[model samples]
Target: MPLLPGAEPYHRRGGPVGVLLCHGFTGAPQALRPWAEHLADAGLTVSVPLLPGHGTRWQDLRVTRWEDWYAELSRELLLLTEECERVFVAGLSMGGGLALRLAAEHGDRIAGVVVVNPSVRSDNPASVLLPVLRHLIPSRPGVVGDIARPDAVEIGYDRYPLNAAWSLARLWREIQRALPRVDQPLLLLRSPRDHVVSPANSALVLARISSIDVTERLCERSFHVATLDHDAELIFEETLEFVRRLAPDAKADDHQG
Candidate 1:
Protein backbone atom coordinates (compact mmCIF):
# COMPACT_ATOMS: atom_id res chain seq x y z
CA MET A 1 0.00 0.00 0.00
CA PRO A 2 1.38 3.37 -0.99
CA LEU A 3 1.30 5.84 1.86
CA LEU A 4 -0.06 9.31 1.37
CA PRO A 5 2.42 12.14 1.06
CA GLY A 6 3.32 13.53 4.51
CA ALA A 7 2.01 10.33 6.10
CA GLU A 8 5.40 8.74 6.44
CA PRO A 9 6.93 8.05 9.87
CA TYR A 10 8.94 10.84 11.52
CA HIS A 11 12.07 10.59 13.64
CA ARG A 12 14.75 12.96 14.91
CA ARG A 13 17.73 12.51 17.17
CA GLY A 14 18.00 15.22 19.82
CA GLY A 15 18.78 14.58 23.48
CA PRO A 16 18.74 11.91 26.20
CA VAL A 17 15.00 12.34 26.80
CA GLY A 18 12.73 10.84 24.14
CA VAL A 19 9.08 11.13 23.10
CA LEU A 20 7.08 8.53 21.23
CA LEU A 21 3.95 9.78 19.45
CA CYS A 22 1.08 7.64 18.15
CA HIS A 23 -1.74 8.77 15.88
CA GLY A 24 -5.39 7.69 15.99
CA PHE A 25 -7.08 4.77 14.23
CA THR A 26 -7.38 5.39 10.49
CA GLY A 27 -5.01 8.34 10.89
CA ALA A 28 -1.40 8.49 9.72
CA PRO A 29 1.73 10.18 11.04
CA GLN A 30 0.73 13.34 9.18
CA ALA A 31 -1.69 14.06 11.98
CA LEU A 32 1.15 14.12 14.48
CA ARG A 33 3.94 15.48 12.31
CA PRO A 34 3.74 19.04 13.59
CA TRP A 35 3.63 17.87 17.18
CA ALA A 36 6.58 15.54 16.63
CA GLU A 37 8.58 18.28 14.93
CA HIS A 38 7.84 20.72 17.72
CA LEU A 39 9.14 18.29 20.34
CA ALA A 40 12.11 17.38 18.22
CA ASP A 41 12.97 21.04 17.67
CA ALA A 42 12.82 21.50 21.41
CA GLY A 43 15.83 19.14 21.63
CA LEU A 44 13.97 15.95 22.54
CA THR A 45 14.51 12.71 20.68
CA VAL A 46 11.16 12.09 18.96
CA SER A 47 9.56 9.26 17.01
CA VAL A 48 6.18 9.05 15.32
CA PRO A 49 5.64 5.77 13.49
CA LEU A 50 2.87 4.95 11.06
CA LEU A 51 0.83 2.03 12.37
CA PRO A 52 0.86 -1.27 10.44
CA GLY A 53 -2.41 -1.02 8.50
CA HIS A 54 -2.88 2.74 8.61
CA GLY A 55 -1.88 5.43 6.06
CA THR A 56 -2.94 3.15 3.21
CA ARG A 57 -6.50 1.92 2.91
CA TRP A 58 -9.42 0.75 4.98
CA GLN A 59 -9.04 -2.76 3.53
CA ASP A 60 -5.60 -3.03 5.07
CA LEU A 61 -6.91 -1.90 8.44
CA ARG A 62 -9.76 -4.41 8.29
CA VAL A 63 -7.23 -7.23 8.17
CA THR A 64 -5.19 -5.90 11.06
CA ARG A 65 -5.90 -5.93 14.80
CA TRP A 66 -5.03 -3.94 17.91
CA GLU A 67 -2.17 -6.28 18.76
CA ASP A 68 -0.52 -5.46 15.44
CA TRP A 69 -0.76 -1.75 16.10
CA TYR A 70 0.44 -2.08 19.69
CA ALA A 71 3.33 -4.29 18.66
CA GLU A 72 4.59 -1.65 16.27
CA LEU A 73 4.35 1.08 18.89
CA SER A 74 5.96 -1.15 21.51
CA ARG A 75 8.88 -1.72 19.16
CA GLU A 76 9.37 2.02 18.72
CA LEU A 77 9.09 2.66 22.45
CA LEU A 78 11.66 -0.04 23.19
CA LEU A 79 14.10 1.40 20.66
CA LEU A 80 13.68 4.89 22.13
CA THR A 81 14.28 3.57 25.66
CA GLU A 82 17.63 2.14 24.60
CA GLU A 83 19.13 5.45 23.44
CA CYS A 84 17.30 7.85 25.75
CA GLU A 85 17.58 8.04 29.53
CA ARG A 86 13.84 8.79 29.89
CA VAL A 87 10.95 8.46 27.44
CA PHE A 88 7.41 9.81 27.40
CA VAL A 89 4.56 8.40 25.35
CA ALA A 90 1.89 10.61 23.78
CA GLY A 91 -1.03 9.49 21.66
CA LEU A 92 -4.30 10.65 20.19
CA SER A 93 -7.66 8.77 20.17
CA MET A 94 -7.05 4.99 19.99
CA GLY A 95 -3.38 5.79 20.10
CA GLY A 96 -4.00 7.15 23.58
CA GLY A 97 -5.46 3.82 24.65
CA LEU A 98 -2.33 2.12 23.35
CA ALA A 99 -0.11 4.57 25.26
CA LEU A 100 -2.05 3.88 28.47
CA ARG A 101 -1.58 0.17 27.93
CA LEU A 102 2.17 0.72 27.63
CA ALA A 103 2.20 2.76 30.83
CA ALA A 104 0.31 -0.04 32.55
CA GLU A 105 2.64 -2.76 31.32
CA HIS A 106 5.90 -0.82 31.47
CA GLY A 107 5.22 1.06 34.73
CA ASP A 108 8.10 3.26 35.96
CA ARG A 109 10.11 2.68 32.82
CA ILE A 110 7.90 5.27 31.03
CA ALA A 111 8.56 8.82 32.23
CA GLY A 112 4.98 10.01 31.63
CA VAL A 113 1.99 9.94 29.27
CA VAL A 114 0.05 12.52 27.22
CA VAL A 115 -3.28 11.83 25.54
CA VAL A 116 -5.76 13.79 23.43
CA ASN A 117 -9.35 12.57 23.35
CA PRO A 118 -8.30 9.02 24.21
CA SER A 119 -10.83 6.22 24.36
CA VAL A 120 -10.82 3.27 26.75
CA ARG A 121 -14.56 2.72 26.46
CA SER A 122 -17.46 3.93 24.35
CA ASP A 123 -21.08 4.54 25.25
CA ASN A 124 -22.16 5.03 21.66
CA PRO A 125 -25.30 3.17 20.56
CA ALA A 126 -23.34 1.50 17.75
CA SER A 127 -20.92 -0.02 20.24
CA VAL A 128 -23.52 -2.47 21.54
CA LEU A 129 -23.77 -4.16 18.11
CA LEU A 130 -20.05 -4.08 17.23
CA PRO A 131 -19.53 -7.81 17.77
CA VAL A 132 -22.21 -8.71 15.25
CA LEU A 133 -21.80 -5.68 13.00
CA ARG A 134 -18.11 -6.35 12.46
CA HIS A 135 -18.96 -9.54 10.62
CA LEU A 136 -22.05 -8.22 8.83
CA ILE A 137 -20.49 -4.96 7.71
CA PRO A 138 -16.93 -4.26 6.61
CA SER A 139 -16.94 -0.48 6.52
CA ARG A 140 -18.83 2.68 7.34
CA PRO A 141 -18.52 6.47 7.34
CA GLY A 142 -15.12 7.50 8.63
CA VAL A 143 -14.57 9.69 11.68
CA VAL A 144 -11.34 11.11 10.36
CA GLY A 145 -10.57 14.81 10.14
CA ASP A 146 -13.01 15.78 12.84
CA ILE A 147 -11.38 19.13 13.31
CA ALA A 148 -13.09 22.41 14.07
CA ARG A 149 -10.92 24.13 11.50
CA PRO A 150 -12.79 23.88 8.21
CA ASP A 151 -9.64 24.15 6.12
CA ALA A 152 -7.71 21.49 8.04
CA VAL A 153 -7.56 18.02 6.54
CA GLU A 154 -6.36 14.76 8.04
CA ILE A 155 -4.89 12.13 5.71
CA GLY A 156 -6.64 8.84 6.36
CA TYR A 157 -8.95 6.19 4.92
CA ASP A 158 -12.35 7.50 3.90
CA ARG A 159 -14.04 4.38 5.25
CA TYR A 160 -13.94 3.03 8.77
CA PRO A 161 -13.10 -0.67 8.99
CA LEU A 162 -15.56 -2.49 11.26
CA ASN A 163 -13.39 -5.53 11.96
CA ALA A 164 -10.51 -3.36 13.13
CA ALA A 165 -12.94 -1.24 15.13
CA TRP A 166 -14.16 -4.35 16.93
CA SER A 167 -10.57 -5.23 17.66
CA LEU A 168 -10.16 -1.72 19.10
CA ALA A 169 -13.17 -2.23 21.33
CA ARG A 170 -11.70 -5.43 22.69
CA LEU A 171 -8.43 -3.66 23.35
CA TRP A 172 -10.33 -0.97 25.23
CA ARG A 173 -11.79 -3.57 27.58
CA GLU A 174 -8.33 -4.86 28.43
CA ILE A 175 -7.04 -1.30 28.81
CA GLN A 176 -9.80 -0.48 31.27
CA ARG A 177 -8.86 -3.46 33.40
CA ALA A 178 -5.23 -2.32 33.41
CA LEU A 179 -6.02 1.35 34.08
CA PRO A 180 -5.20 1.15 37.77
CA ARG A 181 -1.67 0.12 36.94
CA VAL A 182 -0.98 3.36 35.00
CA ASP A 183 0.80 5.23 37.73
CA GLN A 184 2.93 7.63 35.66
CA PRO A 185 2.29 11.38 35.55
CA LEU A 186 -0.51 11.95 33.02
CA LEU A 187 -1.65 14.83 30.81
CA LEU A 188 -5.06 14.61 29.11
CA LEU A 189 -6.20 17.15 26.53
CA ARG A 190 -9.84 16.90 25.57
CA SER A 191 -12.20 18.57 23.15
CA PRO A 192 -15.56 19.37 24.68
CA ARG A 193 -17.49 19.18 21.43
CA ASP A 194 -15.86 16.06 20.08
CA HIS A 195 -18.37 14.27 17.90
CA VAL A 196 -16.62 10.91 18.15
CA VAL A 197 -15.22 10.31 21.63
CA SER A 198 -17.54 11.47 24.37
CA PRO A 199 -16.47 13.41 27.43
CA ALA A 200 -17.57 10.41 29.46
CA ASN A 201 -14.52 8.59 28.18
CA SER A 202 -12.25 11.14 29.82
CA ALA A 203 -14.24 10.97 33.04
CA LEU A 204 -13.92 7.19 33.11
CA VAL A 205 -10.17 7.41 32.63
CA LEU A 206 -9.72 10.03 35.33
CA ALA A 207 -11.81 7.94 37.69
CA ARG A 208 -9.96 4.70 37.02
CA ILE A 209 -6.30 5.69 36.63
CA SER A 210 -4.01 5.72 39.67
CA SER A 211 -1.81 8.57 38.42
CA ILE A 212 -1.46 11.04 41.26
CA ASP A 213 -0.07 13.77 39.02
CA VAL A 214 -2.88 14.05 36.50
CA THR A 215 -3.56 17.25 34.52
CA GLU A 216 -6.52 17.91 32.27
CA ARG A 217 -6.94 20.68 29.67
CA LEU A 218 -10.07 21.44 27.70
CA CYS A 219 -9.71 22.20 24.00
CA GLU A 220 -12.87 24.24 23.94
CA ARG A 221 -12.83 25.38 20.32
CA SER A 222 -11.70 22.17 18.71
CA PHE A 223 -13.54 18.97 17.93
CA HIS A 224 -12.22 15.39 18.04
CA VAL A 225 -8.97 16.09 16.19
CA ALA A 226 -7.93 18.86 18.51
CA THR A 227 -4.28 18.46 17.60
CA LEU A 228 -5.04 19.93 14.16
CA ASP A 229 -7.94 22.11 15.12
CA HIS A 230 -8.20 25.57 16.68
CA ASP A 231 -6.32 24.52 19.79
CA ALA A 232 -3.35 23.04 17.95
CA GLU A 233 -0.81 25.67 18.90
CA LEU A 234 -1.97 25.58 22.50
CA ILE A 235 -1.70 21.79 22.53
CA PHE A 236 1.80 22.03 21.12
CA GLU A 237 2.92 24.66 23.61
CA GLU A 238 1.30 22.91 26.57
CA THR A 239 2.87 19.59 25.62
CA LEU A 240 6.30 21.22 25.35
CA GLU A 241 5.77 22.69 28.78
CA PHE A 242 4.72 19.29 30.11
CA VAL A 243 7.98 17.80 28.87
CA ARG A 244 9.96 20.62 30.41
CA ARG A 245 8.20 20.13 33.73
CA LEU A 246 9.10 16.46 33.64
CA ALA A 247 12.78 17.10 32.86
CA PRO A 248 13.78 20.61 33.86
CA ASP A 249 17.41 20.13 32.87
CA ALA A 250 16.53 19.43 29.23
CA LYS A 251 17.37 22.37 26.95
CA ALA A 252 14.73 23.85 24.63
CA ASP A 253 15.21 25.41 21.22
CA ASP A 254 15.98 29.17 21.32
CA HIS A 255 13.96 29.59 18.13
CA GLN A 256 10.68 28.87 19.92
CA GLY A 257 10.49 32.53 20.91
Candidate 2:
Protein backbone atom coordinates (compact mmCIF):
# COMPACT_ATOMS: atom_id res chain seq x y z
CA MET A 1 0.00 0.00 0.00
CA PRO A 2 1.15 3.49 -0.78
CA LEU A 3 1.68 5.41 2.44
CA LEU A 4 0.29 8.89 2.73
CA PRO A 5 2.76 11.71 2.39
CA GLY A 6 4.68 12.20 5.65
CA ALA A 7 3.41 8.89 6.99
CA GLU A 8 6.51 6.88 6.16
CA PRO A 9 8.43 5.35 9.07
CA TYR A 10 11.60 7.18 10.16
CA HIS A 11 14.90 5.66 11.27
CA ARG A 12 18.21 7.22 12.17
CA ARG A 13 21.37 5.66 13.52
CA GLY A 14 23.34 7.62 16.08
CA GLY A 15 24.95 6.83 19.43
CA PRO A 16 24.70 3.65 21.48
CA VAL A 17 21.40 4.79 23.03
CA GLY A 18 18.37 3.98 20.86
CA VAL A 19 14.79 5.21 21.18
CA LEU A 20 11.76 3.70 19.51
CA LEU A 21 8.70 5.91 19.03
CA CYS A 22 5.19 4.61 18.44
CA HIS A 23 2.31 6.66 17.03
CA GLY A 24 -1.33 6.37 18.13
CA PHE A 25 -4.28 4.47 16.70
CA THR A 26 -5.21 5.61 13.21
CA GLY A 27 -2.14 7.78 13.36
CA ALA A 28 1.01 7.50 11.23
CA PRO A 29 4.65 8.00 12.08
CA GLN A 30 4.18 11.64 11.09
CA ALA A 31 2.52 12.28 14.42
CA LEU A 32 5.77 11.46 16.23
CA ARG A 33 8.30 12.42 13.51
CA PRO A 34 9.40 15.68 15.04
CA TRP A 35 10.00 14.10 18.41
CA ALA A 36 11.99 11.28 16.85
CA GLU A 37 14.04 13.74 14.83
CA HIS A 38 14.71 15.77 17.98
CA LEU A 39 16.17 12.77 19.73
CA ALA A 40 18.14 11.74 16.67
CA ASP A 41 19.53 15.25 16.32
CA ALA A 42 20.73 15.02 19.91
CA GLY A 43 22.88 12.00 19.00
CA LEU A 44 20.37 9.30 19.95
CA THR A 45 19.36 6.61 17.47
CA VAL A 46 15.60 6.55 16.87
CA SER A 47 13.00 4.52 14.99
CA VAL A 48 9.38 5.48 14.38
CA PRO A 49 7.57 2.62 12.71
CA LEU A 50 4.25 3.00 10.92
CA LEU A 51 2.06 0.47 12.68
CA PRO A 52 0.35 -2.09 10.48
CA GLY A 53 -2.99 -0.88 9.06
CA HIS A 54 -2.01 2.74 9.68
CA GLY A 55 -0.56 5.37 7.29
CA THR A 56 -2.80 4.10 4.51
CA ARG A 57 -6.59 4.16 4.83
CA TRP A 58 -9.04 3.70 7.66
CA GLN A 59 -10.50 0.64 5.95
CA ASP A 60 -7.15 -1.13 6.31
CA LEU A 61 -7.24 -0.61 10.07
CA ARG A 62 -10.61 -2.35 10.40
CA VAL A 63 -9.01 -5.60 9.30
CA THR A 64 -6.14 -5.36 11.81
CA ARG A 65 -6.09 -5.93 15.56
CA TRP A 66 -4.04 -4.69 18.48
CA GLU A 67 -1.76 -7.70 18.33
CA ASP A 68 -0.54 -6.70 14.88
CA TRP A 69 0.45 -3.28 16.13
CA TYR A 70 2.14 -4.66 19.26
CA ALA A 71 3.99 -7.24 17.23
CA GLU A 72 5.42 -4.59 14.91
CA LEU A 73 6.62 -2.54 17.88
CA SER A 74 8.11 -5.58 19.49
CA ARG A 75 10.03 -6.31 16.31
CA GLU A 76 11.38 -2.75 16.27
CA LEU A 77 12.47 -3.08 19.90
CA LEU A 78 14.36 -6.24 19.07
CA LEU A 79 16.16 -4.50 16.22
CA LEU A 80 17.09 -1.62 18.51
CA THR A 81 18.39 -3.98 21.17
CA GLU A 82 20.67 -5.58 18.60
CA GLU A 83 22.19 -2.24 17.57
CA CYS A 84 22.31 -0.22 20.76
CA GLU A 85 23.57 -0.73 24.29
CA ARG A 86 20.39 0.78 25.76
CA VAL A 87 16.87 1.05 24.35
CA PHE A 88 14.00 3.29 25.42
CA VAL A 89 10.41 3.14 24.22
CA ALA A 90 8.03 6.06 23.87
CA GLY A 91 4.59 6.55 22.37
CA LEU A 92 1.61 8.84 22.02
CA SER A 93 -2.01 7.83 22.74
CA MET A 94 -2.53 4.11 21.95
CA GLY A 95 1.13 3.93 21.11
CA GLY A 96 1.77 4.78 24.74
CA GLY A 97 -0.11 1.71 25.81
CA LEU A 98 2.07 -0.33 23.43
CA ALA A 99 5.19 1.18 25.00
CA LEU A 100 3.90 0.28 28.45
CA ARG A 101 3.23 -3.26 27.30
CA LEU A 102 6.81 -3.49 26.02
CA ALA A 103 8.11 -2.36 29.40
CA ALA A 104 5.83 -4.82 31.11
CA GLU A 105 6.88 -7.81 29.01
CA HIS A 106 10.50 -6.82 28.39
CA GLY A 107 11.33 -4.70 31.43
CA ASP A 108 14.87 -6.01 31.55
CA ARG A 109 15.61 -4.90 27.99
CA ILE A 110 13.90 -1.50 27.92
CA ALA A 111 15.92 1.18 29.71
CA GLY A 112 12.90 3.43 30.29
CA VAL A 113 9.50 4.45 28.94
CA VAL A 114 7.85 7.74 28.05
CA VAL A 115 4.22 8.23 27.12
CA VAL A 116 2.19 11.27 26.08
CA ASN A 117 -1.51 11.27 26.82
CA PRO A 118 -1.47 7.46 26.85
CA SER A 119 -4.85 5.79 26.52
CA VAL A 120 -5.48 2.57 28.44
CA ARG A 121 -9.25 3.08 28.46
CA SER A 122 -11.70 5.08 26.45
CA ASP A 123 -13.74 7.87 27.99
CA ASN A 124 -16.51 7.29 25.44
CA PRO A 125 -19.51 5.49 26.86
CA ALA A 126 -20.41 4.36 23.34
CA SER A 127 -17.24 2.25 23.27
CA VAL A 128 -19.03 -0.46 25.23
CA LEU A 129 -21.23 -1.11 22.19
CA LEU A 130 -18.26 -1.35 19.78
CA PRO A 131 -18.36 -5.12 19.43
CA VAL A 132 -21.92 -4.89 18.16
CA LEU A 133 -21.62 -1.51 16.48
CA ARG A 134 -18.69 -2.70 14.38
CA HIS A 135 -20.93 -5.26 12.80
CA LEU A 136 -23.47 -2.60 11.95
CA ILE A 137 -21.27 0.34 10.95
CA PRO A 138 -17.78 0.51 9.57
CA SER A 139 -16.66 3.85 10.95
CA ARG A 140 -17.43 7.19 12.53
CA PRO A 141 -15.97 10.67 12.62
CA GLY A 142 -12.26 10.68 13.44
CA VAL A 143 -10.70 11.75 16.75
CA VAL A 144 -7.66 13.47 15.32
CA GLY A 145 -6.14 16.95 15.42
CA ASP A 146 -7.02 17.75 19.01
CA ILE A 147 -4.34 20.40 19.42
CA ALA A 148 -4.42 23.65 21.33
CA ARG A 149 -2.59 25.37 18.49
CA PRO A 150 -4.91 25.99 15.58
CA ASP A 151 -2.22 25.61 12.92
CA ALA A 152 -0.91 22.28 14.14
CA VAL A 153 -2.36 19.26 12.33
CA GLU A 154 -2.11 15.54 13.02
CA ILE A 155 -1.85 13.38 9.92
CA GLY A 156 -4.26 10.46 10.30
CA TYR A 157 -7.48 8.92 9.08
CA ASP A 158 -10.55 11.15 9.04
CA ARG A 159 -12.71 8.27 10.27
CA TYR A 160 -12.53 5.86 13.16
CA PRO A 161 -12.70 2.16 12.20
CA LEU A 162 -15.05 0.48 14.69
CA ASN A 163 -13.45 -2.96 14.62
CA ALA A 164 -9.97 -1.57 15.15
CA ALA A 165 -11.22 0.63 17.95
CA TRP A 166 -12.67 -2.40 19.70
CA SER A 167 -9.33 -4.11 19.43
CA LEU A 168 -7.66 -1.05 20.94
CA ALA A 169 -10.01 -1.25 23.89
CA ARG A 170 -8.94 -4.83 24.41
CA LEU A 171 -5.29 -3.75 24.28
CA TRP A 172 -6.03 -1.29 27.08
CA ARG A 173 -7.37 -4.04 29.28
CA GLU A 174 -4.27 -6.13 28.67
CA ILE A 175 -2.01 -3.21 29.55
CA GLN A 176 -3.90 -2.61 32.76
CA ARG A 177 -3.50 -6.26 33.75
CA ALA A 178 0.23 -6.16 33.07
CA LEU A 179 0.89 -2.79 34.68
CA PRO A 180 2.32 -4.48 37.77
CA ARG A 181 5.17 -5.85 35.64
CA VAL A 182 6.35 -2.46 34.37
CA ASP A 183 9.23 -1.76 36.73
CA GLN A 184 11.37 0.49 34.50
CA PRO A 185 11.49 4.29 34.81
CA LEU A 186 8.36 5.94 33.41
CA LEU A 187 7.68 9.45 32.24
CA LEU A 188 4.06 10.25 31.50
CA LEU A 189 3.04 13.59 30.03
CA ARG A 190 -0.62 14.54 29.92
CA SER A 191 -2.82 17.38 28.81
CA PRO A 192 -5.29 18.52 31.44
CA ARG A 193 -7.58 19.96 28.77
CA ASP A 194 -7.41 17.04 26.38
CA HIS A 195 -10.72 16.56 24.66
CA VAL A 196 -9.98 13.08 23.29
CA VAL A 197 -8.58 11.27 26.36
CA SER A 198 -9.59 11.91 29.95
CA PRO A 199 -7.18 12.85 32.73
CA ALA A 200 -8.24 9.79 34.69
CA ASN A 201 -6.46 7.48 32.23
CA SER A 202 -3.06 8.84 33.20
CA ALA A 203 -4.00 8.77 36.86
CA LEU A 204 -4.92 5.11 36.60
CA VAL A 205 -1.61 4.24 34.93
CA LEU A 206 0.46 6.17 37.49
CA ALA A 207 -1.35 4.42 40.32
CA ARG A 208 -1.11 0.94 38.85
CA ILE A 209 2.42 0.77 37.41
CA SER A 210 5.04 -0.81 39.68
CA SER A 211 7.80 1.55 38.55
CA ILE A 212 9.39 3.30 41.53
CA ASP A 213 10.67 6.07 39.22
CA VAL A 214 7.52 7.56 37.75
CA THR A 215 7.10 11.18 36.75
CA GLU A 216 3.95 12.86 35.55
CA ARG A 217 3.98 16.25 33.89
CA LEU A 218 1.18 18.35 32.48
CA CYS A 219 1.04 20.04 29.07
CA GLU A 220 -1.10 22.93 30.19
CA ARG A 221 -1.61 24.41 26.73
CA SER A 222 -1.78 21.33 24.51
CA PHE A 223 -4.60 18.91 23.84
CA HIS A 224 -4.57 15.16 23.12
CA VAL A 225 -2.05 15.43 20.26
CA ALA A 226 0.39 17.19 22.48
CA THR A 227 3.32 16.20 20.27
CA LEU A 228 2.15 18.59 17.54
CA ASP A 229 0.62 21.22 19.78
CA HIS A 230 1.99 24.20 21.68
CA ASP A 231 3.92 22.07 24.15
CA ALA A 232 5.62 19.96 21.47
CA GLU A 233 9.05 21.32 22.28
CA LEU A 234 8.49 20.41 25.89
CA ILE A 235 7.66 16.85 24.98
CA PHE A 236 10.73 16.54 22.77
CA GLU A 237 13.11 18.07 25.29
CA GLU A 238 11.69 16.22 28.26
CA THR A 239 11.94 12.87 26.50
CA LEU A 240 15.52 13.54 25.50
CA GLU A 241 16.38 14.38 29.08
CA PHE A 242 14.59 11.28 30.32
CA VAL A 243 16.58 9.04 27.97
CA ARG A 244 19.85 10.68 28.92
CA ARG A 245 19.20 10.32 32.61
CA LEU A 246 18.24 6.66 32.31
CA ALA A 247 20.90 5.52 29.85
CA PRO A 248 23.88 7.71 29.09
CA ASP A 249 25.60 6.73 25.86
CA ALA A 250 29.01 5.19 26.49
CA LYS A 251 30.12 6.15 22.98
CA ALA A 252 29.54 9.82 23.77
CA ASP A 253 31.38 9.48 27.06
CA ASP A 254 34.36 7.87 25.33
CA HIS A 255 34.35 10.65 22.75
CA GLN A 256 34.36 13.22 25.56
CA GLY A 257 37.29 11.45 27.22
**Best by lDDT, which number?**
2
Q: Residue 152 in candidate 1 has what lDDT?
A: 93
lDDT of each: 0.89, 0.90
Q: Candidate 2 regions off by >4 Å?
A: 250-257
Task: Write one digit per residue (lDDT tens) for candidate 2, span 1-257.
Answer: 89999999999888888999999988999989889888888888899999999998999998999999999999999999999999999999999989999999997899999999999987889989989999999899999889889888899999988999899989989999988899999999999999988988898899899999988889999999999999999999888788878876633632321
List, residue by residue over 1-257, the lDDT tens digit for candidate 1.
68888789999988888899999989998988888888888888899999999988789898899999999999999999998988999999988989999999998779999999998897677887999999998899898989989899999888988998899888989889999999999999999999989998899889999999999999999999888899988888888888889977456433432
Error in Å for residue 250 of model 1: 1.8
| Model 1 quality (TM-score) | 0.96
Worst 10 residues of 1 by lDDT: 248-257
> How many clashing pairs in candidate 1?
0
